[model samples]
Target chain A: MNTDAATAASAERSGSLLNLEAVVVAFGGLQALGGVDLKVWKGDRLALLGPNGAGKTTLFNVIAGDIKPTSGRVIIKGIDCTELPARFRPRLGVARTYQKTRLFRGLTVEDNLYLAQTGRSGRHLALLRSGVDAEFRERARAMAETVWLADVVGVTAGDLSHGQQRQLEIGMALVTGPEFVMLDEPASGLSRGERERLVQLLLSLDADITLLLIEHDMDVALRAAQRVMVMNEGETVASGTPDEIRVDPLVHSIYLGSEAGLGGADP
Target chain B: MSPTGAAPGRVQSRRTLRRLLSARNVVVAAATALALLLPLFGSNFFVEFVMTRTMILGIAAATIVFLAAYGGMVSLAQYLLAGVAGFMVGNAVVAQDAWSKGLKLGWNPWVAVLFALAVTTAVAFVLGALASRTTGIYFLMITLTYAVIGYYVFGSITPLSGFGGITGIDPPGLFEDHPQRMYLALVVLSVLVYVAFRVLAVTPFGLALQGIRDDPVRMASLGFNVSLHRTLAFTLAGFTAGLAGVFNVWWNGQIDPTSISIGPTLDLLIVAVIGGTLSLEGAWLGAFVFVAANNYLRNLPLVDHIGITEARFNTIVGVLVLLIMILSPDGLAGIIDRIRLGLRRLVQLSRGSGAGPAEAAAGSAP
Candidate 1:
């Protein structure tokens, strides 16, 4: 309703690489995702920004193969994953983190990393013989250390703080080396220190790891994502470089509004 | 020292399951060793009767534990699978009236037993598949329903079952009809099954089941076919139960549809619950409790007066189930774990106080 120009700047980068040409999804009488055409490349760090009711997460669900688009294709690495089951998407290197982070509540943090690893996943007999694969454990240890959670390996996932859980969830996704990782509101429940650490972590990741993040915080979204996609009422309103979308007359009232939120952040 | 002689002992108790030579395993192994050595001092009747029966029944209940612990399933039909062999073998052995009503597949006793296992496993696999999609009460109901169907089918299928119970089903002569000798055979079967399940409980796929138990939706999103893995867990459970069934027939030398009936199934569930749903050793202890309780209850004077005979054991069983469900939601194993944890904490606290107040307070601070 407010930032029409902010959405208009969304360069028509969609409908080319990871094509979702005119995708739509509706549940009962409610339209959740309406005719979205998004094209994402290998290095694209795109952010989906909207109010609480906007279908930012609904779009992430579509990309992660959790839900099927109503008459739209989802191609990953030129493989048509539109109708593939939820499990196969991860194998195709598409990973996701829930807005409400989901870690194995009962298992230790290290075991969570073990479960996330996609190695030695055969029959019971073979698993017994091979044990935990050494290579995967090494990879997991590296991922765990990167998130600054090396000390909490013995701690259960449920024991970790909310901010720590967020870090752990991201570490889990990173374990699999997903080609496209979709994170839903990583900055949602974080404190200032945690948010700063998260931003640094995002900035430190390799440019080749394509990220599609959804955050209501414009400042976090702008700092982390190279391009931002603005959604209003289940449709992409705008997509453009963070700088272009920031000063747009449409984005001003939509995101920053009368007040640009705490600490007078520039829109 | 609350003036009770049953005050806590100073000897350290092993609570954690992490240690290789912990108290639990040591106790279990020591008891098993005692059982194995019992035949030397005991009368022929003691060795021939109780010890023999304990090992045989132990094998049966252990099979049930494998499913519950690793797969996180409560299979009520485990004993029914074993009963198929039991009644069939018994009838073949004792059919003295005229001739035993053998299926006349003309196979050797061992071959016939193996065939029975194969058929039962296939049926169980199909049942497991149907029930695998559901969880909690719904899954339990599905498996229980199948147990009823199995019971009914074993009776009505006259082509294999005939009008009466299976007759002329004799156990093969490996034990030479010696009950104590049969105990050795049973001990072998029990050990094999235990080792097989123990190896699996720590394996990756087994850990996957734990993952599913924690959060199936998360597991699915992590690139796993949750249903398929659960079904496999069920099938493996069925397979072990079927193997136990083979031993059961040899032990009993009988066959009847009642082998797969609800009574035996419920017994398996009871054994699994009392043992502890989490650990492999839980079921072994559960089986010991089951045998001991059954023997004790049958001997009580009121069993006859209250109609709690072998045939009418349900009234008593229902009470026991209710008590266990209330008192031990995580079952006997969980109860034991809590006590051990309490002891460990006490020891830790006592040691901390010895270090003095200020240092002790800081050392144990969260």
Candidate 2:
């Protein structure tokens, strides 16, 4: 309802991608997300940082259309999509990964990536053989290489290591050529070396692909994202350049404490 | 470097050759040859009655396997769907006479067959939509309920189903003249259905169905219509079951309410499990074992010593099913897979080295 002139003008601009206006979600008596407003512009690498139970994942689900907000609007690419179901979101160029890895464990890495590539537009009922899609098969193999999984493309996903599964999850999301990608805690359960590689992968993404990351690792989040938004108890507490949020006294007290020694490092 | 490159090409060709002659392929080829040669035995009661019945029952059971193994839906309505086709064919093709009382449309047999398939598939789609809302045990219960309803409906509808069932329902002229032709036709159709199911498993639709079976929520999030895929799988299974129904009526020369009853419905489930729910070929193998036990087990001296007779045949089947479930949950197919794997391991050990690339390729075939 609070449509300010600046916000209205931004919504009309071609650069505007996702806009949430007073989005609220209530599970019976508990209010998971109390009225929240956010805007994501094209090509922006935005990090959503919040402590545990701060409703970050819940908000991510709302944006991904997995959960409908109790009230208010979800605008994606200048279109209202609050009532749209999750299956149709991919056609709108929206792709996401869950906090818990949701790869098709019984399928091979190539099959997993191929399904993602064809999920939005492929004729799922066609009886054509898997080898018939020579073009998509090539693209899936290329995606496997992108995620550093070229050697084990034929291996079942359930056999992959924890860090490798995380990489495959990202590869599935990117294979669809989505314009907006949301990754929920991509760095969780990853080793130090894997985390560094994840950050490099994130930073090297196409500039045209907007990324919305929910990460707990301060090192990965701060290094990969150019702009950061901090949330606390279901409200946006601060939004600015990553460096500004790192130095904010409120952000420090509520989220980053002295325990996170990497929080203040410039590197 | 030149010698190494030429050697690698030779090894690749050798691996390909080994893969072509893998154990699974050899078994399939041998089975096909045996089925094709079965007519040479001449028209005995065993060939016409027992073997033909096995193929027909196997086709019905294969539909059950398709849904359970690939789609993760353990439906009990497969036999009922087959009965639908049988009844439709009976009603559509059978001429009204003094003894037979029915619609007696007197339509051509081929037209009647297609109509029956369409009607049964439609019914399956509807029932599938209803069952797709539930999963696991609930799905089984719903499909069982449908089978029960079908039995009662057919039994109560005398004008159409004839409480006693329509008799003297003749097969098409081509099959009516020669019993061996019918048997051979069934064998050919069964083989085609098996091949089609195997091919479907690797298709995009088949892979997506497997994905939905494993995790419907994940499939939905990945932009797949989970409910649609499930319902379509049911429809496809229904069509296959309908074909079995048409064959059943032709084989028996009649369609009756007793065929769709709960007892026979569960028997089909037994057949599928014994064959190996995981392997399409297991359907026929299970059916052959079931038909053989039904026909010959009661005549054995061992059975007479044990005081078990033909009337208690189900008791023997129950014990067999229980043994299969306990020893090998995947059924006869699982047993076959284990044997093949064991043989491969033994060969590798006999060679006194780890598996070479060619041996490894052959080991993973199928």
Candidate 3:
């Protein structure tokens, strides 16, 4: 995944603690991101929106420290972490879930959560005589239950059903205790009821935790996010409340298939 | 398949066994213990020639297993890495100017060994970095290329004044030409190497390496620099192979182009794969089978009866590899572990199914 140049740069400076400014990125002649700027305060649930190739996912990549931008700076929680590596950013409390989910197929749910925790890497399997492992296991189980994964503690993340895997992905991101959490298409491949349950889960997620999410399902985004930034042609064309975005002609033109397949996005 | 009872024996036997000692662990421990004591009660000739060779080869194979089983890297260059050590020793004792010519020098054998090890570690790092950039068949191709180039370079290089490969390379004699004394020295080295590897196998590095083999992308997304992990594994494996190389010179009392050639490299692979690439002892077993069989085959009259010759060894090896591949992906270790697990399950059935069962097994099951 390509990270935002601006976000990655700030992450490099203040060690990714969170601020991104006027990030611009392009691929060949296509402007994937154009002077896009956003500020994420702690506990703010921000939603990024746009039609295909609008650079919605590109924004997620930028902030998650996966892809470097053409130019930009990202500061996390007042710390500059523009150049921090993906693993190092996590130590500064940044974590994200992929649109299709990325979990260890061979590792069980417990390990999935365990690996996702943000801290200095240590030997988790080093046989220790101390009782510290008990505390760690308890903490991991509590995190698993928070995402309703306790019943399937031993099930591999790869073997879980689509909805369960999604839940496991969220649980893993949470285990890291990241101050800023970003998710791309978390509602994908979910039944209606599963989507509703996921919405509820997101609403009930811990306070003092910031979230930036991208979803094509309008209903889920409306319910889960406090604000929506509508992207068009690799730029934020409109920013407003959910109700405001619902009736905005520009938002409708891009998302409602009213543009007759605009942006060169083939059906 | 029965949901309750009378399940297919194949499926039933596959049910895992989590005991005080796992089958794999038991096999590893027993193998190490047996090898450790072999020289103790054996005859002097056996101790000097056979056991010494076994320990040296065992160390090499063990290191190979470390890479194959844990790192999931199958390469033909491990012997070449070992060859790095041969020349290191060659520099120390073979050339009159070797010690004088080399960058760092000391007449002390231990320092020479350490110097050899340092060189090997550096080379291993470079090789590992290159190999980690690719995957699957590309890795094999890269390693094979290294083997070919390393062989020719060692044979042709003149700055070292190569004479059909450096000869007269011998570590300072610890026992004044006493074979039994040499055996003791090798036994100590082998035991130390084994313990070091065993400790590392259970470390964070080992787990991450295995994770990469199962799924590289997942490990990478989890913030692991997957390429770095792989390169590190290759480096460690190379270092171990290099250690075996220096020991090889002492075992044979000579170092030559053949020392670094593809012949020994393939032999190392045969030892590793036939023994079973899933466990640490696979290489040891594979080497024993090939070395012992080749020796026995040489004594037979098959050359007269069937026109067999030295060339037949390659075909014979090919046949064994094919059989092992078809019969057990786990190799002999897989078969032995299965049987041991089956016996444990039978005993458990006779009693009652235990509370916590198997901890979700270690192997990747179908």
Candidate 4:
């Protein structure tokens, strides 16, 4: 109801692609997101790092429209999409992969990408026309190749190794050609080589598509993201360039003081 | 670099149906040819009464399979949907007015059947819309509740269903007094419905429905409206059920209150599950099993020795259903798939490491 032109202008002028205004998520008495405010700018590769109970995923859920905030506004491109369900967000150029690999397991690698590509752009299917047209298959194949899955396009996602499944998860998110790609812990369970490949892949993504990811792997996260935001106890404790957050005393205490410490950081 | 080492046969089953000249397609074609020619070569009693009834019921059961297998919404209202068409047919043809037995339009059989189908489809959509919000057992419960309401409302309500229910409802002049012609018509209609279902099973809608079935949340994240897909699948299922309903009334020559009871409703689910909810062939298989059990099991000499008369046919069918549920929860389809997979493995072993597409195709027959 409050569609003020001034507020809209400020958000655009600030280069904010997503603006979360006083977003608060509460489960019974426990507040998962305690009045969090954040701005994700266009073409910004932002990494969200936090301790286990720091509400990083909760915040991601709120932005992704998977969870409704108790009270707040989620503005995407100056449009208040607070009430819009998660399914509608993809049309608005938002795509996300889950914390755990959520690829369609029964579907082949090509089929998974095919569904992702069609999710946002494809029209309501014609009854007689082939569901996966030549153009569609080509697009899916190209995407699979981009994700280093070209050779296994015919294989089911469930049969893929954990690392391959992760790659496929990212591929599924990117296949739709969304403006914002939110990946939750993309490097969580990969081998060192796989993580390095993942870092390279993230870095090579088109700059037009902004990236927001949550990662515990400090090395991978710092290498991939331009900016880093560390969360603690349902609040943004630190926000700066990756280098700045690396040396921030508050970030050190937050990381080192908690059970998930710097000692566990990947070499 | 294979993501999955298993053959492509698993995913291909849903899509392979499109190839008209494939081995599976050829087998289906041959079987259809046999079914069509049966009325000519076989006795009128077998073709007209038995096969005709089985195909009609098979079509109805297929509707259940469509919703259960693709949408993962195991609805119990498909038979109720068909019964809607039956009651509509009765209201249109035999009964003249509310003053008579039912809403007496006294229309021609063709017009009546069409009208009944349309009304049934609309009702199905309405039922779908209501049930789409629920999933799994909840969806089943909602549909079962509606089924109960429909059964009682159509059967016992004298105002809507005429005093003793509309009787002597016959097909058009072309089918009347011509059992073989009616059987042929039913076969043609049933085959057309099955073909349409097969075509739909390979379409985008069908694929999307399968995706939703696998992971509704994941499908939703991919921007597919899970509820909308479920509803549309249910409505499509309704269309087939309506066609079956029309044929059922034609076969029975009457539409009574008992025609839409819980017993018939449960039989629809039983037939579908017994055959294998995932395969289109399962519908006909289940129907054949059901009809055979009803016809022959009741008259078995063992039944008299067991102190169960011919009237207790359902008892035998019930036992068979229990056996199927316990032994193979996926029904006959699961059993058939396992057997095919085993044969493929055996053949590959016998050939000493030569695993060709031909062997794979032979294994994927079901």
Candidate 5:
């Protein structure tokens, strides 16, 4: 383990914001997530980098309570939340955006954000008051402004461009005031400008909010996250800062698939 | 600062213009006026039996529309829910005698209706609880199973099953022998049910239910209780179905096993489909079409000459339903929506191509 992993391990001993103790998730004969132990401290920005089928998204799903692990424990804020369904996790300040946009397509952008805002604070089960409450609308307006979608607030979400949809998804995750937000491939289909905007948005997030993101775009991921963990075949291959991981032999070999270019240089 | 941003004043004016140009409000006003004035012009059979029945049936179908359109939980057990309430009214109201068998308990009709509504609402809550955990076809199957169970349970009851089910269910003395008075009460009830549906649609609960329908996992992650919202939606639908059930018994002065059977279940489903599953107005239209077609189809000269009998009415209705489903999957409302959109586009196209710049600007301002 690198120094960062060592520190994260010690932080887990002291009850980190999120802890996965040898969590294993198997789908039939295929083990999507091998027994993996991980820790995310409060206010930490973690970028999970991996090739396809590396189980980063699976790990995310387990943490988000979408999938229960085959064995081991998932502790959120010092409480074991392995048994709680995904819906209950949100009340505990866990939020996530999907790889594919999972927005309410029929609803306007403002309405979608308003729903998220109200879900966090308003009486969501209220039958008399409209869902588009004044406070919620205000918050939605502010969030739309933050995501640069203010002008299109009335547009249905399905009608937005792909990049705008991704921005709106991120805005939705952020609007809930979640202590822990897990974003799955937020920069997957973005143009350069949209990716820069997303990186800026991620970087400018409140320090009190912990973020765990899965991204294939190494540039955006490295810039936005404080710590990076590279996984291969459902196991952690490397863990360190962006600068350390940039030159790591394992990372270089994993990405480039050849050790010949390195020529066995001493670190 | 947006590239596509139009002025707020321009948007508002365009919205107002669209509203003024739209024929929706005019149609609604005319329909409401015609409905309210129906009793003043029509015969007792037309006024009380046909129109009132249509409205009551519309209320029942509206429940399905609420679930299918908003919550995305299509159910076949809603008519069964109505039957439950109808049976409750029968069990509570009809005086205990040789005709009552073991069913009647001698309660007043008003009390019976209230008790039936409450019980059916509770049953709805139970069904909602069970059905909320499922979605799409599984949800439909669960409700269908429940409906089948209800049908057989009522069918097996010796006292209630005679000549299909219970009879001699009389309404209160206030409207005694006055079909017009009964019709008036039904009109009020139907209107109240529809208004309640409208009120619920714009509420937080309804919106949350819609969110759940569109994407359950997303709604769950956003902190909305998906199952709870679904259950609540089902319960609301059940309340409307229950009211229709009570009114149905009062109208026919009896309850029958056939009323809750698959035949009527399909009838309700057809009503929702034909009118438009997404709109209450569609439900009313479907009901009107179903009732009017059933009433008038056999009276045609072609039918009389070809020896078409009353028993073949369902066959004709079935063919009509199949034709409508093939032509417009979204039903009558969807057809109307398509026509409106096409007309608007044509108007815009004509203005953009031939009219002056000012006309084009006005048309596209919104």
Candidate 6:
């Protein structure tokens, strides 16, 4: 039964970029995720939708190698990285932004983006400034422009407005040029205009990069993502294209009381 | 477009020019120049002894500041590392007097200095490796434990440290003959160290260290090996502390266990805190304050009237430190920054009345 479920979940395994086989995570007696199986194909835009405490962020953490699943294999780019630490994720072309927006508050936006780039490629022990540093600086500037933070590139992350900080969080995640990007609620605190811009930015990303976004805003999530997966009580309740997930009765029932409508409504 | 009708490039250049001529920069430049020419005005006792002592202590305190401010590792083992270098210098170099019993390998002073630095750096790397895995209070405690262990080792090892410590150590001939030249060399070294740290603060590694300081978990997720970065910072601080140690042994003409004890360790930390743990320049300012207070504060008529002489010197320093902390938690550097900001505001206010609001807003944008 378990093998059948695993095969069923990862049926399209030929072009799969990320595969989670029987991933289970438990915090003592409470099970955060119970035997979850998932497969993300290359260039896939998958939106993970779930209510509060539904194990969406936990799955992202496990995939990002921040938290090792209690019992399961996390295969990314055909490599088994279940036991690998978070620092090794960059080598596998994986980047993730935290739900709480973890940023180096004391550093400027440019420095934050530059550090994200350098952490993946540049030597951490190079004491002397070099020509390569100039290239990284230029790339950081380009990323700032990409995130619509060009005007405030020199401002410290801590001093930025909440919307701007969220934008910068996305910028840092994308600066490393990872093949797979996971954004946990990138529009959590953004204004309506900023949210629209963020959706546009998400749509404008390279088609070759796989994106897994966790968002509560049905409007932003449905508009940006091609595929949608719904999780409830640490289990996959439903998975389908954006349109199918919107019309599904189970999704409506799960989200109706809390979110009111599955249609593009601002929740 | 700027209201001043200047090109963006020209505006940037103008801002840079303004920064170059800012009040703080002018004051710093003037002070550096004065320090370089201090020997001409001051008595030999003041210039040679007090000034040189301040520079040595300043270098030591700078290591603590570098580790704490940039790396966020408040290490108390900096002085112990310096003491290691001093011990190496004493053991490796030839003693001037026959009464001193040590290895006395009679190596060249410069060579011995290099050797001492190498040893100190190795020890620092080892200590960093041990303590980098821990953070906050645990890191402080582990480093403090190392300092205590070092003190005991130095005190117990009579063969190398000698009963009273390896004394009769002689400086190179150039410094030994000319006190002013020695002081000037120290000044030059201090400037170099200061500039080196400033340049380092903007480098990729330096920025990464600061990132780790601000958020180690975020840094780790970004693929930075947080522990390795912390360890490397500790090793670099060790090298700097070693530099201070070599100079200190030369200046004092000896190496003793008392120098690395818990008391002196705390004293170095106090110096760093008083100078401003966030600024490198605070190291010297703090050291100068500490050295001056230690030397002259007890001689005041007020102290005599209070019936507290040199025996209560620490009490006087404690009160001063308490006052400074109450006034400015960031230390002297914080006070200086506030004063500079106040002066800039005053200047802006005067200019605002003449130029109107638009230009004032642009000027105060930063």
Q: Write the per-residue lDDT of candidate 2 for residues A72-124, one digit (tens) a residue.
A: 89998777889988887887689999899988787788888877876787667
Which docking category, incorrect, acceptable, medium or high, applies to candidate 5?
A: acceptable
Give the TM-score of chain A, superposed on the true chain A, for all candidates in the order listed.
0.87, 0.92, 0.84, 0.90, 0.89, 0.93
Prediction 6 global C-alpha lDDT: 0.87
Fraction of native Cα contacts kept in each candidate? Answer: 0.41, 0.52, 0.22, 0.43, 0.64, 0.67
lDDT of model 3 at position B155: 70
RMSD of model 4, in Å?
Answer: 4.6
Per-residue CA lDDT of model 1 for A64-161, tens digit only, reads 77888877777665566789878877755677898988887766676677778752243323454343455565666678788888877667788789
Off by over 4 Å in 4: A1-14, A130-132, A258-267, B1-23, B95-100, B356-366
Ranking by DockQ: 6, 2, 5, 4, 1, 3
Best by DockQ: 6
Q: Judged by DockQ relative to the true structure, which candidate is superior, 4 or 5? A: 5
Write the residue-wise lDDT of candidate 5 on A38-155 in tens digits. Answer: 9898899999988899999899889988899999899887667898888777766888999989998877787788788666554788876643586677788799999999878877
Displacement of residue A206 (Cα, Å) in model 5 is 1.2
**Candidate 4, DockQ to 2 decimals?**
0.44
Which pairs clash in model 6? none
CA-only RMSD, every prediction = 8.5, 4.2, 7.7, 4.6, 5.5, 4.6
| Residue-level lDDT tens digits of model 1 in B191-211 | 677777766655677667777
Local accuracy of candidate 6 as per-residue lDDT tens digits, A22-55: 9999999999999999999999999999899999
Model 5 residue B207 distance off true place after TM-score fit, in angstroms:
0.8
Best to worst by lDDT, what's the order? Answer: 6, 2, 5, 4, 3, 1
lDDT of 2 by residue, B1-366 (tens): 112565798876776787668677679879888877987874577889889999999999999999988888899999999999999999998875536856787888999999999999999999999888788899999999999999999999887797689877788899996888998899899988888887798788988888877667667777888888999999999999999999899888887898799999999999999998877889999999999999989878888888889988989989999999999999998998898778878887998976566554344332
lDDT against the true structure, per candidate, is 0.70, 0.86, 0.71, 0.81, 0.83, 0.87
Each candidate's DockQ: 0.31, 0.49, 0.21, 0.44, 0.45, 0.50
- Residues B1-366 of candidate 3: C-alpha lDDT, one tens digit per residue: 122666666555655343325556676678667766776787765566666776677778877677766676787788888888777776765545543333223357777788788998999899889889677788889999999998888777744525655555556667547666666676677767766776665345555676677666555556677788888888888888887887787667667776667877877777777888767666666767777666557668656578566668888888888898898888877777788778877887888884334445333221
CA deviation > 4 Å runs, candidate 1: A1-17, A119-125, A129-132, A252-257, A262-267, B1-18, B41-60, B83-98, B298-312, B353-366
Worst 10 residues of 2 chain A by lDDT: A1-10
Instruction: Give Cα distance to truth, residue A96, candidate 6, Å.
Output: 1.2
In angstroms, give how far residue B321 of model 6 lies from its true place: 1.4
